[model samples]
Target: MNAKKLQKKIFPLPKQVEVKDGALKLDKVALKITADVHTAKQAAAVLEKKLAALGIGVCDCAKTTITLALGEAPAQVQFAEQGYRIAVTADGVELTGFGAQGVYYAAVSFVQMLDREIPCCEILDWPDMDFRGHVIESRLGSDLMEKEDWFAMID
Candidate 1:
């Protein structure tokens, strides 16, 4: 079967991206997730849980690796609340961000990169918009808004 080429389809596109190869499966890699701060630790835990759910093995002692770390990115002043950089190499992968939220976004981006299996690549990214939020407003209508619906929406 033909392999899929890496394409730039990520949301809030990275500032820079370079693809080196087509596919890099996650099965045989040693995954390591680390956090430098409390919030980052929480984010790392979430990432680790997600990885576990995917049935991907994680270990700190392997030659081929996937290192997920949460720490202050170089020149933290440049990245806002949601900025990150991720690099996938022959040896392993490295994800870096400015804060906990940044690290979370990095993890998300890394997952997205694995759509067709991790492509050998490098990326530098940061949020273009300073703030992004949405509101769901409802008013009286033919269909009344149920209390249960409101509770679910809030949740």
Candidate 2:
């Protein structure tokens, strides 16, 4: 969907709409959505769509990064069969990391969070630290919260 169309869908009430000129900025440097051995093609597909929706794209489909074994890590610590770590920097957003569990969790978080309809635009973001980031999914499905109400009506 286009950004204008998306904005309308997300914030429907006409009165509540507000426009800002600089709200959408494209980074001079390309956005890098990298993943560490992002093995699952299905999961990767979802991530690709989500990033595009967020107005971010891969500068180079091949970027080197890291991966962590979920089973090897303790429960108290964030773990994944694989991991999914995404970051935003001054230049653009980065898919900094991912693995088994991480990929699954990142899919859920991103589908829910990233704007799924940003038109050709730019963004400025940065990683808090060159460290670890994690996302967790208790249940897996297309049950995004915002769509629950819409789903109920359809059902």
Best candidate, TM-score: 1
What lDDT tens digits, residue by residue, belong to model 2 across residues 5-35?
4334431111112222222233212222333
List residue ranges in candidate 1 displaced over 4 A.
1-9, 70-81, 135-155
Model 2, CA-based lDDT: 0.37
Query: How close to the true structure is residue 81 of candidate 1, measured as C-alpha lDDT?
Result: 57
Number of colliding residue pairs in each model: 0, 18
What tens digits encode model 1's per-residue C-alpha lDDT throughout 1-155? 11123335666566777777654666545656675556555555665676677776667665767666655555634655577778877667887766667777777777665532566787777776667566565756778668888787789
Query: Residue 115 lDDT in model 2?
Result: 52
Q: Give the TM-score (vs. native) of candidate 2.
A: 0.33
Q: Which pairs in model 1 have colliding backbones?
A: none
Question: TM-score for each prediction?
Answer: 0.65, 0.33
RMSD of candidate 2 to true structure, Å? 13.2
Residue 133 local lDDT, model 1? 66
The regions of model 2 sitting more than 4 angstroms off are 1-40, 51-76, 80-84, 96-98, 116-155
Per-candidate Cα lDDT values, in order, are 0.65, 0.37
